[model samples]
Target: MGVTLLTGASTGIGRSLARRLAARGEAMALVARRGELLDSLVIEIEQAGGQALALPCDVTDRDALARALASAEAELGPVTRLVANAGGGEPTFVDGFDSAAFEAVIQLNLIGVANSVAAVLPGMLARGDGHLVATGSLAGRRGLPSAAAYSAAKGGLANLMDSLRIDLRGRGVAVTLLMPGFVRKHEPKPGRGKTGRRRSKPFRVDLEYATARMEKAILARRRQLVFPLSLAVAIGLTRLLPFGLDARLLAGRGRRRPAAAQPPRTRL
Candidate 1:
């Protein structure tokens, strides 16, 4: 199998997913801005008799990302799978809105994925075989009060994947979009909380559980996958509500929680 190039591979979903794929004997091209973490992950994978190459890169930088992809292909063979999972966002409040901050989130979450696809899409099209997967969020489906920027960026990504899937339908390339809600930053230890509950959000799930579902969807080449089912349903229902009602319903949800206050809902 050709190498699977995964961005944001130093932590959270990308990190865990890399290990899961490696266990299946697939070679990996792990990309992230944290060089040390990537190196350590590489060592861990190697120790397990798995193949992995750490390519530290900022997905938002087009030229740098291209170089990283080239290096990955040179070292581990063609990358048959591209998981554009690197992204970040900060709370945007109407009271103190910052255009520059909004742009930064857009660049990282939307343009970054575009850059990644630009680097590998040509090769995938030429080979007529490949998979492109992106980790979006259910937040993208609705505009949360303090997370407008985050919601906008992920919303754009979801639409981008939709268009790509339609465009690549007749070709051999496949596209999959993952929309997850309230995924925990770490795995919950047994007896850590009441019934080992790590988060209070409804249907909140841990990293390992979330990544397992993502892995299955990618392997199955599903067009779109949303979880947990309860949260997905809630978000989906919001879309059917009147604009005014929907806005009022989520008005008190994300009021004071700055985006920086929590780990990125997506990945790096």
Candidate 2:
């Protein structure tokens, strides 16, 4: 819709991004499983003098995503930007994982992103101007003991976008992979966050900080943006570690120590 299309707008970072973009007066199309939530966001955006269309659709549905884009075009204008953010935090365990949740994560986090990209690319290519962004996580660069599926999906998305970036580089389309380090949400208590020395055992990130990061990347049209340098470096190192040591570290196996008692905040 003129500038942006957002998926996974029901809550968390997606919702925050939507609000921020609206405040900046960008036209948008919001998608999520909950039409009710999109409705509420649409009301807020419109009242703030921004144009938006709420196209409730599951990001995993290839055809549905394409149809929603058409609707967004008809209602607003050309789609100039897209946030492929529909995702799931799944398989939240080691051996105790749920097969269904694991599968669903791949479908939503990986294939869903693919669907969103496919839906918008044709028009963007024709116009020769557009930006495609996908919300990835630091976890994408490493496998956490419990978040196997999530890590896999996000990692897959990063790889997928890498190739897409190459294919579209000279086509006048831009691709950005935003890797955030656990941005906390107002709700979702597990991520609300605390402060100081204990340093919020949970995944700690402030909304403003994340929004600023996204704003810069979106404006500059950068590629493969990672955040919180410390976490970024850690994940990068994980790839170079010997498999045994890496496995032990990630699984929380015997390693001397309290330093990691709180564990790394690698959650989605």
Candidate 3:
């Protein structure tokens, strides 16, 4: 396998995917803002006999991201696979719209992905062999009740990947978009509190399963991969619903919890 560079490698899905890829002995360049986490991950991968380099940088900064990509290429070889996975967003309520917050999300989710692609596309085009993959969300299929900014960002990312795929067709660079439903970081602890109680996450899939499926899609160079199959079907069917009824059914369901007040954590 060729060198693979992934953003948002510090935590969550990004971290899980890195582990899976590392286990397969792929040369890796892991990028994220959290230096400590990335360092620890590098140690873990190296200890496990995988080759990896940790490059800590914020994806929102195009210059920094470019530098990170350069460092990765210098250390691990040209990045043959680029995963634009750095993204996060909190609730955006229409009643209290925060332009700055919305802009931040767009920068991170949409523009960040573009930056990653721009940093590596020229080299990939020159070599005529590479893969570009991104982590989109099931929420991108439609506008959500309280996550307007997030939904818009993810939707734009999906469209961006689609366009890239079309433009790069038959050029030897493949693109894949992963649209996943709820995926938990870990199992909830029992009897801690109401908050600790396992809330029902729609069609939630474990991290391992999600990463495994994503790996298969990447390897197959699939255009789009949505999961779990049940949620994908549900989201597709929602498109047939009348707007007014759909709004009513989804209203109040996505209310932002006050405790979610912490600025969105920057991760994949």
Give the number of the best model, judged by TM-score.
Answer: 3
TM-score of each: 0.91, 0.86, 0.93
User: How well is each residue in 1-268 modelled by candidate 3, as lDDT tens digits?
Assistant: 7888999999988998898888887888999999999999999999999999999998889999899988998888999999888887877867668999899889989999999999999999999999999999988888876788888999999999999999999999999999988786777568632465433556778888888898888878899998888987877776778857777777776744455556433212
lDDT of 1: 0.87
For candidate 1, give the lDDT of residue 6: 94
Ordering by lDDT? 1, 3, 2
How many steric overlaps are in each model, in order?
0, 0, 0
Our model 3 lands, by Cα RMSD against the true structure, at 2.3
lDDT of 1 by residue, 149-229 (tens): 889999999999999999999899999999988778855578753475333456778888999999999889899999888
Clashing pairs in 1: none
TM-score order of candidates, best first? 3, 1, 2
RMSD in order of candidates:
3.3, 5.1, 2.3
What lDDT score goes with residue 26 in model 1? Answer: 83
What stretches of model 1 exceed 4 Å from their correct place? 187-199, 255-268
